[model samples]
Target: MVDSPRIAIDAMGGDTGLAVMLAGAEAAYRQDGALRFLLVGDEAAIREALTRHAELAEASEILHAPDRIAGEDKPSQAIRRAKTTSMGLAIDAVKTGRAGAAVSAGNTGALMAMAKLALRTIKGIDRPALAALLPTLGNNDVVMLDLGANTDCDARNLIQFAVMGAAYARSALELAQPRVALLNIGTEELKGTDEVRDAAAMLRQADYLPLQFTGFIEGDRMSRGDVDVIVCDGFSGNVALKTIEGTARFVADLLRRAFTSSLRSKIGFLISRPATELLRHHLDPNNHNGAIFLGLNGLVVKSHGSANANGVANAIRLAARLVRDDLTRRISEDLANFDTHKGPEAVTA
Candidate 1:
């Protein structure tokens, strides 16, 4: 029997609930025997799913959590009710060292609330941010932070995001000099709102990260893969994320219409089938299935609720990789450096 750390999964969180979670855990365990799991949610549902996928019974176990944190629940209220939810229980497991990490395809706000209220954030990490990542240009994916965590932030918060994000980029993405940039209204120093300009100034002086600190990146430039870490307030960051998702859908719909509109266009699409296949693979959500809630005391991954088995499996694989890499320790050490190289705040006229 191969022994490995087990990941705690909130089986009740996603849209498909226990079924998809079970399939994911089973598939992952079969692929990598070293991966064990704890499905934390409604006991009866978990047991039923387990029977349906009985071969993984030994490698996986169920931990009952009677209540659920609804996706619509306010973050503040969810934090108070954290103990009752499966995601909260899973986070508790990680905190107690019973699990290597926690995986949830549930309420994003609730997960953040539970993790912060239960597991706590590392010192110097003012507020934890969600880095929803996907492959960008140059085989590099950008880490955009505060993705619906804290709506308003100060300089120190943005600085912490950079430090943690850089460590993640280095460890996860293998980027030697992950270029960190502030997401702003404009690339020029003078063109953004007061908050963005001030944040940019702070990042320029805050020198804790091993990653290269680039100036500013506009939202339009995000697709160009201009920066490795994109820092912004949660409000702006969430907007950017939704915009990207919407644009991808719009483009795909447009492509389908273009290809099927005429026989000549269909023939051209067939001739270009290889390149099209490559592009589709590159843009597939399943291929980029996990988002890391960084700065938490331990690794916590959130997958889209609509994820199929492959997506859930990918999330577990991501958590396992993060655990083995000792990501939390590395991030802590790097965050400790924030006080070292930080210069006097830039004087803006």
Candidate 2:
């Protein structure tokens, strides 16, 4: 039997609390029986929850945490309590090598802060970016980065994001040479802020990199099925991600209302039920639940605080896959190749 890496989970982190977290872990265990878990939270609560999942209970171990990071807590405040909180202990497991990766459905800011502080950035990486998979009309999902990690970034930061985003796409999407584009106001070379244009220029010049720099892509064209990786600063990227998610919900809700408007519409809905179901599945956030903190020395996956058992299971599965694939080493190798080929100099020139 293949020995899968043990995943450390913040059992008390999400809005739904321990029951959902344990259920999610159990679901993942059912999918991959070889998977193991290190559950971090109030020991009595975790133990109580596990009793309902006998198989998962046998496959898991619990670590007691006296505290929990509240949703309103600031990152700084959370950091001070790192050694005692479930979220903090989960991340520390990755840092100490007790777990291959950490997964938490907690405050985004606190999770990012704790993970960065605990794992630090990879050798050549200056900052880690939040990257996630967005459903697109394309054959594969698109990889978008800087999803609220760094609000303000320079040309160099954007360039680095492009590289890391590409590496993530290659690993998660299994692309040979991901087509990358800078998210901009327009596709015109002269459009967008100075940092964006500069990043585009640098990407265009760096032919030695594994990614194919396809110039700037507009926000409206993000889901057009052409680009594989979209790079932007946290300010713009966060706004874009939220907008995309909101629009998806809007469309899904609109369709439901429209189909129930009248008998005729309801009959039509039944006729198109198959198509609508596919569309619903495509827009479901649970299908794509994990957002990764790329460039960190160790892997850390952020699950939506409101995510359900299936969503949490998806996050756990994602963390396991990233560990098995050795994603951090892959990014480090690509970063080294970029430096060795004088990519920075080429970009500056």
Candidate 3:
């Protein structure tokens, strides 16, 4: 008997299907006493998984969507015609106000298409970007938008991403007026392709420019603590982000190999166990498991495709918190008043 508290999760949408997703729901319920989940997927599979977790079984509600959005199918076509797909059901739960948020790690393209077609945008947002919240140094984090949504973007779309990303930084990261940086090869005005240069000019003339804009953030400065939001086309942002992720994993693996190389190295590892564990946990992608598809009418989180139970649970919890934060409303309000916030007049992006 789930009452007002509910989260819709695509239990059959991930790589491991209902097994991992049920484990995640159990974890989320254990972590937060007030949270309840509305699991969506194949009924038989979900029931069997829940039978293993008594507590979660008692608090969860299962909904059968009857179909799945396969990883290879084209999102546009699949979303449009796959009426009984799990992705559609989970999103429908939010659209009908039956659930607070939706979580999935299935085919991202399918999820995005279904969500937009179902919930639409939140007034000002033209193209909804998939904004991934990356963990930064200190107690803060920055917002990176267009993670893999739209490959081609104009000057206006980039600026919109800046504003939306800044607002997300403010509400999500609690920044006063988040420093928004355009991803570029160099910080100089003369640098970058014509597209980036044109975007820079458009951003410079923006009324919100003085307060939010940070000119350009070069590839080397990505880890710097100065910027709170980085805006770029989906193609560039996704490539740079994936590169960083790959590098982090590579470094961690190299360290692991070194630590286990010999008896002497093993002894040294014993001495540095705590420090090494901290670093390993910090670099683990599962530790930073959840990502937001920002600019939608409601909050949604996409976990990794290969995410395990703990990762899935973490993603559900992340979506629940974001839904509680009123992120959609906050973003809309902030962008609505961009002209009054700071440099040039308001322009569509």
C-alpha RMSD (angstroms) for model 1: 3.4
The ten-residue window of minimal lDDT in model 2 covers: 340-349
lDDT of 2 by residue, 1-349 (tens): 1268799999989798888888999999999987999999999988887879998898899999999999999999999999999999999999999999999999999999999999999877778899999989878999999999999988888888888899888878889899999999988888999999888887787898899999989999999879999999999999999999888888878988998999999999999999988887888898999999999999999998988999999999989888888889888888777787765454222
lDDT of each: 0.83, 0.90, 0.80
Please list the residue runs of candidate 1 whose C-alpha ends up more than 4 Å from where it truly belongs after superposition: 1-3, 206-208, 267-274, 341-349
- The model with the greater TM-score, 2 or 3, is 2
Pairs clashing in candidate 2?
A: none
True-structure RMSD, every candidate: 3.4, 2.0, 3.0
Give me candidate 3's TM-score against the actual structure.
0.90
lDDT of 2: 0.90
Off by over 4 Å in 3: 1-5, 202-211, 339-346
Tens-digit lDDT track for model 1 on 123-195?
6676888987767886787878878888987766777788888888887777887999888877789977777
Pairs of colliding residues, candidate 1: none
The clash count for each model shown is 0, 0, 3
